[model samples]
Target chain A: MAEVMEKTALFEFLCRMGDNTLILGHRVSEWCGHAPVLEEDIALANTALDLIGQTQLWLEYAAEVEGKGRSADDLAFLRDVWDFRNVLMLELPNGDFGQTLMRQFLFDAWQVVMLGHLVRSSDTRVSEIAEKASKEVAYHLDRSRGTVIGLGDGTEESNARMQAALERLWPYVGEMFASDETDAAMLAAGVAPDPASLRAEFDAIVLPALAEATLTVPEGDFAHKGGRDGGMHTEHLGHILCTMQWLQRAYPGAKW
Target chain B: MVASVEQVWDWLDAVPDPEIPVISLVDLGIIRNVAWAGDTLQVTVTPTYSGCPATSIINLDIETALRDHGVEKIELKRQLSPAWTTDWLSDKGREKLEEYGIAPPQPAGGPERCPHCGSTAVEKLSQFGSTPCKAQWRCTECLEPFDYFKCI
Candidate 1:
């Protein structure tokens, strides 16, 4: 039973990742035409597109491997709010360009490291997906880091706002690094990154970024947890899921 | 003496990049070699990157295009040991990519010139673009935004 539970847990974790990217991508797509500048607008839209693309690949693969008979489309569009497994960090609103960059920088920093570890996953399919995705995310993280430092130090108003965004986002940051049994075994099996190992590297990459951005890391002793193994979510997921799954639900035999 | 290789090159000119959809893989520079061994047509290709989602699509597209023309057998070997890079794009491919509204892969030397107006006065808006092969860039002169196929 432990083996079966572990496998189910692994499936759920992948779903969390897939859903996070899908929702965040949808939110970023909202900025497609209305960015402060044309180039930046397209930039945000581009990231959004890539994230969604990644989401589709992973979600479809996850659905297939788990024998769920749901395509990526079915999982993405048919799930209800409680069924969603993405962390709350991804569901938060896009406050401004500053907020978007903060969220992306934080997530991408961890993801690049995570994907690097996952490239060697015991599961060949997962490994293949990560091996392919890592390069793309590396490029993604580079852009996010550049914008964070550039805008953070660019001008007076930009710097202050970026700092505020970082502060607002810092509290939720710890949730990603909190590992449970699913993590420890996966780490030993080389199916996942050891949160213990990732914690330091993630800090190394993120701390300097914050310093350059002139932002302070939130000094909270409290760390948020319980999204990955599946429990609780922000209020936003239901609305997002409703809209996403509408097409699949409304027309069961739809083709794209 | 060997017959001219230009015919083989022309045959490959018909196989286009799956993502960009405008330029041939030959122009994109991923088709490394086209050779003949007995009656079989051997086409050597490399990916833009190892994990590129379009890699398999491109390979299948090349084989199908060649087979439809009665090339007996196609050997599409993926050369990933040295890895794929963006530097392979031909000048013609660059021009065609720009015409198609997707920038060709930026040549090494910092970044690429703006595809819209050939201005060096271009800026990178994002590292990602509408597709994986491109990055968003805007030209100062033409004031028209375009995508730059980023250097891998």
Candidate 2:
């Protein structure tokens, strides 16, 4: 039964990743024509494309491992809110460009490091996905970092907005590095890196950039968790799902 | 008669990229490996970007090309290990990109040059282009706008 539990744990891990990217990509896509500048509009969309692409790969593999005939589309569009395993950070509304950048900067920093370790996963399929994805994630990290610096140090209004965004988003960062039983199983099975073990590197990559941006990292210890196991979620995810899944659910096998 | 791996490669070399018709997929370094297992022929490809819309089309195109060549059993694998990069682009691919009016990729973080006039004076108009793989840039010297294949 331990073997079965480990398989379930791996499935959970992959779901969490796939859901995170899918939701985040959907949120970013909202900026497709609404960005402050034309270049930014295209840039955000490009990032969204990369993320949604990664989401498809992960969920497809997740379905394969489950030995179900489900395609990636089935997993992404058919799932209800309670079925999702993405962290709450990704579901938060895009308050402004500053908030979006803060959320991305934090998540991308964690992801790049997480993927670095995942590239060595004993499950070669997982490693292959990471090797392919981390390259795109690196570019994402670069774009977010540059924007954070520009806005954080730009002007009084911009700096204040950035700092406020950072304070609001920082609590979510802790959830990413928090480890539980699923994480332990994946790590022990050599299929995932220990989230706890990656904390130092996460900070190392994030802190200096924050310092350069003149933004303050929140000192709060309060963290909201539980999405990894699909128990908890923010209010935002339901609305996101309502729109994202509409075409698929309504058409019941829609294709472009 | 079963098709040899070399013969399959020759057929694939003629399949141009769906978006950029000037460069063949083989020259673009998208085709990674061709092998034969018993009577089956297997082709491997890597996408330029995880999200590139061209991936599926390219896959179908390969299958069609091979099928037309009388290959009975064919398997196409998508390999992501040692992921695709702009550096994989062959020299002929680079020349084709330039000749087609898109600036070939430079070293990562390198400056963009105008494919029109071969001038280094250019400004990026957008980080994105007509497609995900290219960026819009305008040359100062030639005063002509062009696409630059992003150094991924």
Candidate 3:
């Protein structure tokens, strides 16, 4: 690949990584106090804050590199649904505490693998941010994994719901490590991992936990795709945008 | 005539949080000690929590504000050993926090009440609140969720 194309790929992948956290952070914040139980609610909200904090640095760096007047808030709030580049898996609704736990567990497990790989990245900015964020994410993943087991193995109803949630989210899982041209370039440049390499580790971490929870791992290679380059999004994203961007749109540039 | 610590204290009052914008570091009890070592003024400050996003900005704000007050050769030292405890919050700060719709740190002991409506019958919604220094809490009476300035 040409040097320019390689640079563009690195830029694009960084933005993808940044926007995923921003979008997911915004989504999880919706459950602030509306959670079913208080302890679980705190756990979810805390995790959400960690993701948002990590993404702030990532997005700010991305905007600086993009060399546009657009700030992270502009990219996060002003963009249309189609303009966002977050993964489809993250856009799924907060099904329930059980499902949310399962989702966080799955995502955190993958993030640990990705961040562990990312710390070795040649691109210093991304690696530096990932290194600082890795410590916070380790705690987040542990909390999520604990709750997932508690819910998945806790009761008949919970086990059934956990199983259903896992099956529903599984189809979208493969797309996570599907390295496109941008991913290829970032991997080659060492700005990001070769997503191709993290698959076994991701599976290894999650499968054993799922087995312990008495949860069945879904099968078949039929992967549902979308969100690599922002083709589409889940309906929940619209509501998320409405609430998140309300203050920004109401008074542009007003510090409140 | 010599300037007293009380006079120096008055000069430091204008240092508001760069992020929260409502409370001064004095109100937050982050301003630990203001003393003079020769002509050099030593300002000892502690952040509300480690890894708080606002610490860097707050440090800069303190330096600038004090310099504006004509204090020269200032040294800002961070005291992380005792760490920062919410017990440092002044009574006036607690009142201001309640009026501002966010709760103050629970009085240096047990049982943190809800800030929105003074109810001990409160539950922690999350360990993380709007910022890392806070814990999300909701009052059963008011049902309003508020940030608890976490005890260090």
Candidates arranged by DockQ, highest first: 2, 1, 3
Query: Chain A TM-score, candidate 2?
Result: 0.98
**Which segments of model 1 are wrong by more than 4 Å?**
A1-6, B1-12, B18-22, B26-109, B112-131, B136-147
- Per-prediction DockQ comes to 0.27, 0.70, 0.14
lDDT of 1 by residue, B25-116 (tens): 88888888787877667788866643356877888888888777777666776543233566677888878877877666644523466665
Query: Best candidate, lDDT-wise?
Result: 2
Query: What is the C-alpha lDDT profile of model 2 across B1-152, one tens digit per residue?
Result: 77767888889989999999999999889999999988888899988888999999999999999889988788999888889989888899899999999998887553467888989888978767777788888998989989889888
| Per-model i-RMS | 4.5, 1.4, 6.4
What is the alpha-carbon lDDT for the whole of candidate 3? 0.75
RMSD score of candidate 3 (Å): 7.9
Is 1 or 3 the stronger prediction by DockQ?
1
Tell me the native contact fraction for each prediction: 0.28, 0.66, 0.20
Give candidate 2's iRMS in Å, 1 decimal: 1.4
lDDT string, candidate 2, A205-256, tens digits: 8899999999888886788886666777888899999999999989999899
lDDT against the true structure, each candidate = 0.75, 0.89, 0.75
